[model samples]
Target: MKLRETLEAQEFEPYIHITRGPGDGGHWARQYAHRFDLVLISGGDGTICEVINGLSGTDKPIAIFPSGTENLFAREMGVLPDCDQLIQTLKWGRRVVMDMGQVNHRKFLLLSGVGFDAHVLLELNKFRTGNITHLTYFWPIWRTLWEYRFPPMTVEADGEIIVENARGLMFVSNISRYAVGLRICEQARYDDGLLDICFYHCTHQFRLVKHAWNTVMRTHCRDSMVTYRQAKKIRVTSTEPIPFETDGDPVGNLPAEFSVIPQAVRVILPP
Candidate 1:
């Protein structure tokens, strides 16, 4: 109510809805889909993902107010935490259309991952609580590294076939940022109309440590053990069922196809 009051004091009319849960906002937003000019999401990544799924086919522009843990997508776009500045940005910012990734007809605002990252998400989901933070992801990530086994998989992207017999994480992204300010896909651009694929193909602990170091230094993609490619479509299939996650929410297991919808959704951005 305070945020709404602040916006109203500035003479901007904002539609506010208090949803029952994570998935409820999406459905509620869809109910008012055609009436609102802009959908301003004021929750976490999971809430934004639900809104994205709800507004998938429409041309409505979205402005995010980051109120959730691990606001990777919002931080990448340079969205700050000040409500007054956010209101001003909304009033005067330029509109840009960006690509969204689709998995089995669901929409994801940021990257999607299969195998290792998904397992981490599952662990986090079980352990996470109010105001999830970097440590929430970090602890599980370390645990997953210690106990998790990487499964072999086949990935086909942009006509290049990779059949790997090792365990690691595969990240498919339309944006550059990941958790804790990591630039996992440095070459990725929001409006580039391409999907960036990063595969960690090494199974050894020491090599994985090296990969982590390179990732922190933003040089992982250049390694021989790390495969990076740009494709319009990517098909990932594993020998067994592997969990998959999109935008920090666990969806389901794969055999999955992820395709880019270029310039698909309109977003209000800082001018």
Candidate 2:
């Protein structure tokens, strides 16, 4: 209501549609996909994922208003907190073509993780109730560290074939940062027409601790155990079924094919 009022007061023409239940965002997005010039999403990562899924292949751009606990994608674009400022900025903002990642047919704006990270989200969903909070992920993160077992997977990217035999996490990002401001893929650029892939090949507690420290210091990519690469396409296959999460939502199990849609979607960003 506040956002709507602010936009209306600014004399900016905006359309508002509310969803009734889960997965209703996709339906609402499709309904307005052709009618709007740009779609302003005012919700969490899950909602943004739904909107992207709906607007895939369309030329219309998207502007985001971060209203969720973890607005990972919005944070990357540097969106402001004030709704009025956001509206004013959008008036003069340029639409930049940014890369989007696809797992099978689903689209993701931020990052996707296979193995460890996916297991964490899977566990988190089991305990999530109405209105999720940041604290809601604490237990799951802790449990994932202690009890989670990693699966070995073969990763093929940039003409390099590597088999990771330990319990580890793989991050395929269009943007540099992941959750908690981790620069796992430090050299990544959103509009680079390529995907940055990071693989952590250590499962030992001490090594994981060291990797986490390096991640905090933004030097994780330099670690010998961590392999970083850029590619237009990546294919991962595992002997056991490994679940994967895209833009914070669990999509499906591997073998997963990740590819970059170069300069595919337009987004309103700061000048």
CA lDDT of every candidate: 0.83, 0.83
Candidate 2 residue-wise lDDT, 1-271, digit = tens? 8988898888878888876767798888876778877788888878987887788878888888888876778877788667765876678886789888888878888889998789889999898888878788889989888876677888989567855554577899999878777778888888998999898886655677788899998888778888889998899888898899998888899988889988877788765
Poorest 10 consecutive residues of model 1 by lDDT? 158-167
Candidate 1 TM-score versus the reference: 0.94
Candidate 1 lDDT: 0.83
Clash pairs (backbone) in predicted model 2: none
lDDT value for model 2 = 0.83
Candidate 2 weakest lDDT stretch, 10 residues: 158-167
* Per-model TM values vs. the true structure: 0.94, 0.94
lDDT string, candidate 1, 209-239, tens digits: 8888999988888888888889888888887
